[model samples]
Target chain A: MMDILSRLNNYTTIVVALGAAVLGMISGVIGSYSVIRKQSLIGDGVSHSALPGVVLAFMMTGNKSTEVLLLGALVAGILAAGFIIGIVKNSRIKFDSALALVMSVFFGTGLVLLSIVQKTPDSAQAGLSRFIFGQVSAILKRDVYIMTIVSAVLILLVILFWKEFKLFSFDPEYAHTLGFKPMRLNLLLMLMTVFTIIIGLQTVGVILMSAMLIAPGVAARQWTDRLWLMIVLSAVFGAGAGVIGAFSSSLAEKLPTGPAIVVVISIIVLISILIAPNRGLISKALRRRKSKKGWLEKGVKGGDII
Target chain B: MNPQLEIQLIAIFIATACALPGVFLVLRKMTMMSDSISHTTLLGIVLAFFIVHDLSSPFLVVGAAAMGVITVWLTESLHKTKLVSEDSSIGIVFPLLFSIAVILISKYAGSVHLDSDSVLEGDLVSAPFYRLELFGVSIGAKYIYISLFYLILNIVLIAVFFKELKVSAFDPMLASVLGFSPILLHYGLMSLVSITAVGAFEAVGSILVIAFMAGPPVTAYLLTDDLKKMLFISGGMGALNAVLGFQLARFFDVSISGAMAVMTGVTFLIVFIFAPQRGLISIALRRKRQKLSFGMLNLLIHLLSHENSEYETREAEHCSLANHLHWHEGYARKIVDKLIIEKLIVVENGILKLTDTGRTYTSNEYSKIFNN
Candidate 1:
């Protein structure tokens, strides 16, 4: 363990691990609101929509800076969110249909742009495809610093507006009555969500970023009922998964880091759903068995109630 | 057959196959579940390949079908806990399974022929090269046959159990009372989706499969209210999209599946805006028409109620309508002109009065508005 720690003390592993951990925590913190609002799939929609932004940014700038690409992704993701809201409000289409439409169209357009870039006689476009399935080892130390700053700002904002967000997530109408502008708050949350998704695009890719948003919140929900506690727990779980996944992927040869992190978080969620005290499957099953045994001992037949 | 024609045929067949089950998914508000199932089936294909050591093994189909059911089951189970929502469960489950498959593929890229690119965006241009041979005879593309088989199976299933499916989709309680298990039918339909999804996975990637599955059904949904018509229209729309999307790809010299998915969205967009009854334009038009008629009726009722009042009589001129109703003068004039054209009102010596026809209409409108 000491030798492994010393080996991982190198600059690259530490930076990658820290970057993944920050991404995981930010995703968890922002994802809690979306999950509680029952808009979890919007993360999926936003992440997929960011693909075109990345490509367009590269095309326009003729450079592969992470900041430029992420800014482009932010613009595209916000537009996609607006498009979804417009469709849902202006037409008879439901939320899911709007989500599916924006996701597929944006991703498809991204593919078209990517193919165009690939067909061009420029070798610089080689690494652009790696955004689909992210290569964490390729992340430089500067990218880690950007991730750290973004995540710190996100966490600080979440802490600052905790009450308003809680009300917005739990009861928007009541929040409106209390003089809070739910729509503006919603837009803010969505903007933050888009930012979180864009920053993680270099690490988790578009396809699997939704998992990072969902799994941590899901796993933490099993352990608590309070909103604040759930958020804290979710961040911890997400960070733990990130560290473990990064470590294991580094130890194993040819194991991609993003999926490894996602798989780790998923295992955490699976265990939480199965073994958590009151909400878990096993505990519920055990309680049912106890009730059945109690009924039998009291001379009550199974069909008596029916 | 020409390779282009063969590709179009495969595209159409795949679209039609997906659309059959897709109608049910759209109606039941489970279109996102199909997305989850398609992604999770990647793990199924990987596991099946590892076990059977062949990409063409029938067990891959079985394994993928089973995985689809498992995907639905896990999502439903998580949903049943009341801890996570239905969409969250889906968001959680499929990515986990899909990521595992992706990790496995990357870890063992040497031994396995599967790549993430093919899994996400399939090579329809090369689909024709993988031909199926049967008994020393050359068949068409293997995916074409596979899609055809599933399409027929889906048609037969829907035909035989139309009533059950209809009942379960619209009202599962009624289905249960009528001795039809909605759960059983749900799993059965999910299995068919799984099978169809796997068949199309190699021809069109998982993303396009989702577009093909949901797009045509939703487009048809905007055009019709009848389920039977919805199914038929969606199938036709799917076929049409396939051909048009192929032409579009050729025109642009871009990725075929990406072009196909875009065309699917384009088709839906056209229907969304232009469908006769349920479209955005129509709905807006209907609302505008209702507002105009409602304004005219209100004017007639106001005249009828205040015919003998001295103050109303003093303000009963054609120009007074703008003040009486607080509307713009042009809008008031337009409404007055339309009412006069309908012979519901008349202006005599600058005092407006409801005609005999207008009096009866106002009373009827009054009763309709208040009595209901």
Candidate 2:
């Protein structure tokens, strides 16, 4: 523990952990909305599709600035979302099919562009491929600041539209009847999912980023029925996982930070599923057993009286 | 066989192999399952590697295929809990397994020949070098044989269980009542998906394996309604995508697998837009034509109803048609001109008249519409 704490005193470790924590917190909050709304896999689609944007940003600017690259990722992610929506809306294809098709195709395009970037003889391209698996240890102090600000704005938007989002998520038809446009709210929520995914692309990378988006919400859901509490608990879980994952990966050698974060969040989800109050597997089983015992005792007494 | 030819053959076989199970996946609305299974299979390969200490062992495929089924089973279990949605369940399970695989690879197997990058981004260009040798005789690439084995396995299984798969996919309850085990069929199909993913991932990568599995089947789905025709069309689409993707990569000197995925997407888009019956363009054109004909029908019906009525001058005039029909002037004029071109309606002294053909069409359509 002391060794881990001492390592956190390192400047690079602190920056990476901070960035990851902020990313985890916002993704958790937004991810709860997505999970409840049954749009969990959109995160997966958006993250994979963001790769092309990252590569394109690098190619156009010839630099690896986090802001510019992420901007590119945001554009590509939205465009991919558009493709998914368009496909599902216009054709007989279902949502999952469109997502899988769009996600793979976009990632493939990114890979092609990445190959092109590699042959350009630019030394900056060396760091570009890291976006695939992500190396959070390479995140600069500046990147963390940007991530924090963007995440703050996202959280603010969530707060401002909390009641509307809750309504739309739980009962979209009812929300529509109540004068809220479900389509507009859904689009807003999807944009949040896309932005949260874009911000986390550098921290958890594209492939495993979906876990970060999904696991916390799932874990928090096991502990609470209220939407606000679920959101808060999810954010806490996400931040905890991010910090621990970043710290542990930093402490060890050869452990990639993105996978480390995913592993940590997944563990949280597992434990939450097994033991959280009310809805957990063990708790539910225990309650069932108690009810059965109570019923048996009452039945025996009634038989004696008869 | 030549190296380039071997590569193309491997791609074609892999594409077809993926498409076989892919048809069911698309039909079952479980296309994302392939995406999840493809990622989780890495853990199987890694665990199998640790046991055999060999990268080329057949156990890897078995282990990967098992892991794929486990992924489906786990996701279903989580969904059964009712705490999380099905998509969330899949989103959670696969990444956990894949993360463990990645962590294991980086921590213990870092020194080994295994790496996640090569698994996610397969090198089809070097596939020809993994040649198969049998009893001092050399054959084509080893991948060609592996993929061919999988292709044949898929074809045979799908052929033998066509009825069961079709029934279960369309309606699980009906299939179960008919004495076919839904559990067995579901797992059997999942197992096929896993094995196909493993077989194809060597050349196309795990991610693009989804493209090979989903893209062609979906495109074929837009073109046909029959199950057998869909399967055949999907297979043909897979083969066509492989050839086109190869040529594209050759022209651009890019990654063949990536190029293949792009081609798969491009082909799907083209088919999505231009399919004869179901394409977006055809659907829109059909809608437009229907709108025009409906307008002409309305015009004819109106003129016939008021031919000698007192309101004929009031309602059937060319200028008054817009008010009666609630159409914008431009749209009214456009359809009116279309009717004139088709000899459906004639304008005489500011009054509208229906030709004999137009009158017959209107009466027939009116009866057809009312009967329906």
Candidate 3:
């Protein structure tokens, strides 16, 4: 264990791992609300929409600063969310259809823009494609600092409005009658989700960002029913997956970091679903066997069994 | 055929193939399952290629079909656990399988001609170059032939199992009682979707496959309520979108698949806003018209109910009507003016009285609201 820790002592490896850990924790904490609200796939839509925003930001600024690109992504994500809301509200289209439509169109538009950017003479456009399936080794100290500050702010907001957010998530109509504006709270939650997704783009990329949001919350759900414990466990699971993913990718020769992180998180989810306490598959199977045995023994004692 | 014409033909074939099963998917409210199936099929393709050591094997389609059924089965099983909801289960399963495929392609299959990038955003320009050879001569584009074969298969299956598919989609309990197993139909349709997705994946890529699968059917859904018309219209719309999308791609010098997806969204948007019966514009207009007439009827009812009361005398005055109803003066006056023009009410001795026709109208509306 000590040898493994020392092997991971390289400065870049430590920074990248720390950044991923923070990203995973934030995704888990925020994604719990989305998952509970049954809008788990909304993150998928917002993440895909961020692509066009990133490219448009690059085109307008002619620079590759992460901050500027993510800001553009944030705006685009909000626009996509708005379009989804608009379509679902005004038309006969259901929420899932609206989500799929906006997601595909925004992503297609982004691809068209990316092709244009590739055709341009500027070579700085080279790094922009990395946002598709993130290249986490590109994380510098400054990028980590930015990630830390943004995640800190998001965590603080979530903490500050924890009760209201909980009520809003559990029952919006009840919250509305309690004079806690559900619409505003819903928007605030969306904003936080968009922020988390933007920060995570550099680590997990758009294609797999949604998995980061979903896997941890799902894993944590198996362990407990309390909201606070679920949030805490989800954050820990996410951080664990992130650290493991980053470390493994660094140790291996050809392993890609984003997919590595996703694969690790997926394993955690599978294990949780199979072996975690009362909710696990193994536990349920065992319980069923026990009950069946008890019933058979009772039947034999009553002379009802052959 | 010319390369451009061949590309257009392939696009149309792919569109129709996806749209056929897509209609049932949309009707069943399982659009997201198509998204999951398309992604997980990548795993099947990778595994099949690994086993056969060939990209063009017939077994790849079989593997992909199996994977698609597995995806649906896994999702349903997870849902049955009651721990995870349906969409969350989908989010969990596909990413896991797809990431495995990606990792496998990156780590072990790097030397092969298979590239994940082409799988994601297929290069339709090069699609025409892959010729279908039979015996000693070249026939046509390989992708076009493959897509057309699947399109025909989809049509035949849907035509033969139309009643079963419709019953299962709308009411699975009734379908099962009628001796048509809904679960079997579900897997059959899912397998068809899987095969169509694999056939189209090489030509249009996965994202556009989703667009073609859901978009045309959803647009057609807005146009008609009958399932037969919806199917025909969806297929026609799918072909139309392919041609328009191909032309748009040429005009803009963009990705052909991307253009097609965008065109599908555009057509859906247009139908959403302008469809005669179910469109947003028509619905809004109908709502506004209903509100106006409802307000007028409500005013007449109020007058009829208070025909001999002092409140009627007061409300007979122009501004008093607004005050009594707690409406703005402008709104009250507009309703009153429209009512007078319709001759539903009359001013007599500074009291509002319901005309004979107006009393009948009020009773009709009252019965419509309460008696039903």
Candidate 4:
């Protein structure tokens, strides 16, 4: 029992999980747009890209403040986004192909940089590779404060841009006709995504941050069609998962919390996917089976659309 | 004795296997699903490792592949339900499986050797250590042999059913009537994707493996439109990127995975901006030239107009020759310049004259317009 308490008391683990909750909220909010835009994989792309930023930040400032590291993450994340956009706009590359191309290249650069960092003699900071796979157990209080501030800022920005984002998302041509610039709006949205993603690096790390960003939104979407509600629910669900995962991992020793919280959020998302109200798999299958039976029982009417 | 040379072969081998079937994946628009499959296979790996009790066991890889296929199956099956979309279905299913895998690793295997770090970092440093021995003579790394077998399997499958696969990818509904089972081809491709994904796990980790599967083929598709060109270009791009990327990664002393991804992006960008007709610079220049030529036509129209015609005026009323306004100042000048270019117009005292050749050309066009 004492072992459990001691493990739980490791402030890093709790801080890490709490930080994940904050990141999860921000990711959940942004991920809704990503999913609706059919860019669920962009999360995966940006997550891997964040690695170079972390390493570069460490190399320059030697102060791994969540701020400096986040700056690195923001720069790299935005560049990756620009690369994807460039591929789509400038090349004949299909959207999926462009996303894939950008994802791999950014991830490759991060990996190469990590290898060099690891080889730098007498540098303990080179061990940031562990951060790549997500060892959130080392998250400190300052990290949590930063994450919280970032999350708050993200939520505030979303509120401010809610109307603009909605118009830009579903009807870019219409938005243009109404004098709203799609490019400018999209740039802002992508920037917000960068800030949120950068803050998320400490908890989910470079590899799985996108997963965290996208999963909760996916789950919450299953439960609602309303965009506002979806974002709110996703944030709540993501935070809940973080709390649960951290609490559980705290029961054991050596269980890295980043992966742990991600796992929990994933499970929550799965539950929603499997059985959420109108969008759940079981409900749909059941509806399909019922409809098939109904059609078999009743003669097909010429006017019946159902 | 040269590490670089030995690694280059390894890079070539991986890229060949990756690009071979990646051609089909890009065509199928299933690259995203393949990526999800790679991630969800983590559950398969963890569960397999747990069951088989060893990470190095062949069963671990096999288990992971099986899980990958299962993910594809589950995602596809669930996607057909009206409740959600394909992307959402994938988003929901695999992350949960992967998360469960992570939870399991934390609970049961926290003290065990396997962890997320090992999974994501991959066993690249140690991959060369695992050799495949044939009749007491080591052939190569076991992964090399395994991946080669998978590669050959993919090649044979592609060869045997090229026509069917092409038809299905281009138009599944039509392919269905032609007695080609698109579902069968789909499953086959998904299985191949899974095999490539799980097999490369040790060499480059799951994310890089997915990158190899999707990135190069995607880049190739951009440069070529023909199916055959796509296949060739995709494979060529993959092989080229892998070799250069691996070396760059090694040289930069960074993780191999990150460097490999960056090189893929850079290559695609270079092709995008400078490649012949489709490249950015060329396309922009072509547009500029088109606009300039168009502007010159407008200038000619203004020049040939009647002195009082004011047709170039932004808010001018219709011409008195409106019925014949098809030959307005803009049209007259356009006609004259076009005639001159066609060797039909001549200048006498700064006044335009239509040569016989110009008259004939104008007659045909005027007749067509009048008739219309």
Candidate 5:
């Protein structure tokens, strides 16, 4: 056990990685408000939009500091959010396409900027590529602090706004009549999303960030509609994926840590999506079967079973 | 442009062409099924690859399309068991089928020559380069051509079946009333969706297929009210993004899929912000202008209604513009002033009166309050 601890210390990187995963779950759980608001793809949109911010931050700072780049990423992500809302509210395009639209445009710009980064030669630039695919092993002790602080703030905000998020998610029109501005709530939701995606960027990269933001929340959603519980459960699922994926990648000398972590998250999502006891596809079927059996005894035969 | 970009053009065109059917898919809220078809088709592809010992065989497309249909059928079967939701039926069928295919891939990893990676993310770069020359033009990027064939097939089918698809999408009950079998349209759309997906798989991969299928049509929908225009505009948007996506990919040196996704996003943003009729900026401006006018009119009415002010007095002040006027004030004031000049309001010094013409606006309380 001591040896395992020591070896684990050698990759304190995985702990940071796990922290990001936990951040992901918390964001996802909180993000479910947006998701159920039927704005599920916002995470994907914002994550893609954050790319150019990262690259621009790298260019401006002459460094690849996650904190600096993340700030830039947040700005880009928020702008993308504002733009998406603007499109949906003011124009005729639907929410889904608007999200995809922002995602592609911002990500395209990021790719172009990334190419420019690749062309430049410098020591900091050497590690700049890490943001593209997210090599967890490249994590610094400082990254842990940023991730922890941001995640804690996020969790606290979600806790405080739990009822608001819920009321807003289920029925914004109702909330609006009760003096809550659905637009403000939606903006807050998208802004928090910006922060989460930026924090998770160093661990998951842009393209796969949606997988992190959505997969866990989606998995947790299968378990319960109670927002707080869903969040906590998603955090656990995300953290578990992180720790396990980070460890397994370490086990394989050749496997890259980022992809490994993603695969783990994906696996968890797959399980929860398919077979989680309550929320899983299998469980839903089993629950339906049992209910049908109960109904048969009650003289209620065949229908939607809903 | 590199060979990759050119290949991607073929990929994007085929993708855009195929995505024409996707507009219907997303609108009907069955996107997950499209995703499932993507995964389950892997089983079919692998099945064909093993049977024919050829990755490029045409049989692979047929087998894969069949598997896509089978997935839907199996899901429908699970749904009929009186025991599961449609989502669960989907969730249960695909992974099990996919895992079985994965197991087979591992079992024959050496001789299979078809890995899960290729099946999921079909090496678009190399696959597109596989070609057979024709008469003299050397025109054999067969995957693109095959996808084009499917694309045309889809377009023709959609063109012939426009009313049916529209009726069903708007209201299946209405469609059924009109003697159109929604089930047939549903399956037809699903089948076309499957064929397009399978055809585009070798060129652009599944994720891009989804992006194209959902992205541009949605963009077009934002910009237009007409569905026919939506189909045209969405396909155009997809194709435009493909070209831009290719150039953007080359500019950035990233995955074509990533670039195309970004291009779709950019196009959406532009349309969102500036699409003359449906853009945010325009709508906001229009609303701002309308609100200002409404607020000014409210204030004018309040002032004129005070104690002894006549409507003509208010009209003179409005025309003079001495006070801070709201944006909508002009519109309301003009209408009110026109009423007063025409003898609707009899002004007595600094007083206003509401004649029959002026009183007309207040009659409908519901419409007045709602501003509907």
Candidate 6:
């Protein structure tokens, strides 16, 4: 416990936690759009698809810079989103089928590429697999700066197009009938989501990153019905999970940061599902019990039943 | 038997086994469930290992299969709450379970030879070394037997419940109305998928299991609408991909399973774009042909309608027709030329006139459209 507190004041711990918190916040923000749009699992496909891009970026530039690698991840994620949309649009294959097929195939390609990179003489490729499960301890100060800038820009855009996104997410056909271009809005939303997934790859890796995108928004949704409030609450829950997860992982001897963050957020989801008002399991059950009790009492008191 | 042959046989067996259940998964739109099951089975193995303290226990398979069904049930229940959407439920459930497993491994089993990488990306090249022994006599690789067990198991279950599986997958309501329980079938299929995943995990890993599960079945779907034929073709494609992927892996000195996945994708892509009747190119070509024929019919109708009318000369001119029909000038000329070549219309001093054939065809088409 003493070691954890002393380490919390240290430079690297603060930086890593900050990075995770920012990643959580932005994922929560953009993830609300995806979750509401019923495309939450698309983030899973996009993250897996980003693997090839990260590796290809390293291969192309021979630079292990975070910005360069993430740019590559973003491009690959967009391509994956495009493929999913295209397959669902053109073929008889449903969305889930296309997502599964695309995700596995793309990750397979990444594995092949990773093997090729291993065979190469380049010693710099050693850390590339960190993107798979993530290595938050390896996150540098520069990566945090990049994440902050990207998060700011994403937030700014969300604010600027708040009304348009609101209409698009809720009722796209109505928006289209009102002369708004839903396709453009959808494309923009997908791009933002891809960007968020790419930036967070360094923290939670590809697989767990999906949880970060989903758990926060889902938890926040139980607390409120309004979209804006949900977004705000989701950001808070996500950022909180990030801090606590990062701290706990640091305190532990060999705990992995990525999965730790995911576990924390998942606990938040469980709590939200059970205890939150209105939409919570417990509250709904209580309300049902109250109504049934009232009806039974009325029946007995009025002698309407034996 | 050679080790190389054993590896190929194992790959083929796993591929065929996975493709069988994959047919139902694809048809039922639960391909993502396979993905979730593949990830959470690791947790099942871990929890089971903690209790049994034996990696090779048959109970491990049961544990993993139970975990897979639980994952599906949880996701379905979470969705049933209607608080969260189905995809969100899936996105939430698997990662949470997988993360707990990861944390447990790192925190407790870090030194117990449970490398998560090997689980996620298994090494097929090493499978031939684990020899199967039958009464003290070597019987090639153990994975070959393992995969064969799963293959036979899947084939038996699917064959025995072919009609039940078919009806439930296509129409669950009808299946229940006819005395078949969809829930029992759902859990049964989930158990089969879980065991199949466990068997294949040491060979192709979990992610490639999804490729084997979804790729072949979806590709087969594009080629045929018949369920039996789809199953046959999916299994065949899976086996073919295994052989080709093995060869490619050898040539490129890459991961064998990765190459197989890529090949699965390649085969699907080729089938998706060029299948004789149902491919993308063929579909697009069909649409184009329809458009051309519709254009020809519209041209014939226009010429027939304007024939012998006071505005015939002005309305039937190629440029005037383009303007009136709102078609591109080039498209208008092309349609007019097609009509002329078919003797449907003839130009008399820049005025278009419909022939007897054109008149009869246009009136028939017009009446048909009206009747519909």
Q: What are the runs in model 3 whose C-alpha is more than 4 Å off?
A: A1-3, A300-306, B56-58, B133-138, B348-351, B367-372
Rank the models by DockQ, top first: 6, 2, 3, 1, 4, 5
| Candidate with more favorable, higher TM-score: 1 or 4 | 1
After aligning candidate 1 to the native by TM-score, how far in Å is the CA of B315 from where it should be? 6.0
How high is the CA lDDT of each candidate model? 0.85, 0.89, 0.85, 0.72, 0.68, 0.89
> Which candidate do you rate higher for lDDT, 4 or 5?
4
Q: What is the lDDT of residue B254 in candidate 4?
A: 60
Candidate 1 C-alpha lDDT tens digits along B181-276: 988999988888888887887788877788888888888888888999999999998898888888988888877777877888888888888989
- Candidate 3 lDDT, B188-227, residue by residue in tens: 9988998888788878777767888888998998999899
Regarding TM-score, does 2 or 5 come out ahead? 2
Q: Quote each prediction's TM-score.
A: 0.92, 0.93, 0.94, 0.84, 0.72, 0.96
Distance (Å) between predicted and true CA of B60, model 3?
Answer: 3.7
Name the best candidate (by DockQ): 6
What is candidate 2's CA lDDT for residue A117? 83
- List of clashing residue pairs for candidate 2: none
Error of 5 at B247 (Å): 8.1
Q: List the residue pairs that clash in candidate 3.
A: none
Q: DockQ of candidates 1 onward, in order?
A: 0.59, 0.72, 0.64, 0.46, 0.19, 0.78
Which residue runs does candidate 6 get wrong by more than 4 Å? A1-4, A297-306
Residues A1-306 of candidate 3: C-alpha lDDT, one tens digit per residue: 786777699888898899889888989999899889888888777887887899999999987877788888999999988888787768777877777778877777777788778888868898675775577777778878888898899999999999999999999999999999877898889889988888888767765688988989999999998999999999999989988998998888788777888899999998999999999999999999999999998988889544
Ten contiguous residues with the weakest lDDT in model 4 chain A: A126-135
- lDDT per residue as tens, model 2, B1-372: 989889899899999989889999999989999999999999999999989999988999899999999999999998898888889999999888998898899889988888777787887888888878999788878888888998999999999999999999999999999999999999999999998998888778888999999999999999999999999999999999999999898899888888898999999999999999989999999999898777767777778888879888888888878988899888899988998999988889999888888888888888888887
> Judged by TM-score relative to the true structure, which candidate is superior, 4 or 5?
4
Which DockQ value does candidate 4 get? 0.46
lDDT of 5 by residue, B1-372 (tens): 346655766866675775688788757756556666876788898888788988768899899999999989887876564434455455446655665565456556457567544543345567556665687665656666666677789789989999899989989999999999988888888888888888776666654566677777777776777889989888888888888877766675666655776777678668767878777778788987776556534644554445244544554444443343443445556655655676545444544555565445433432566686
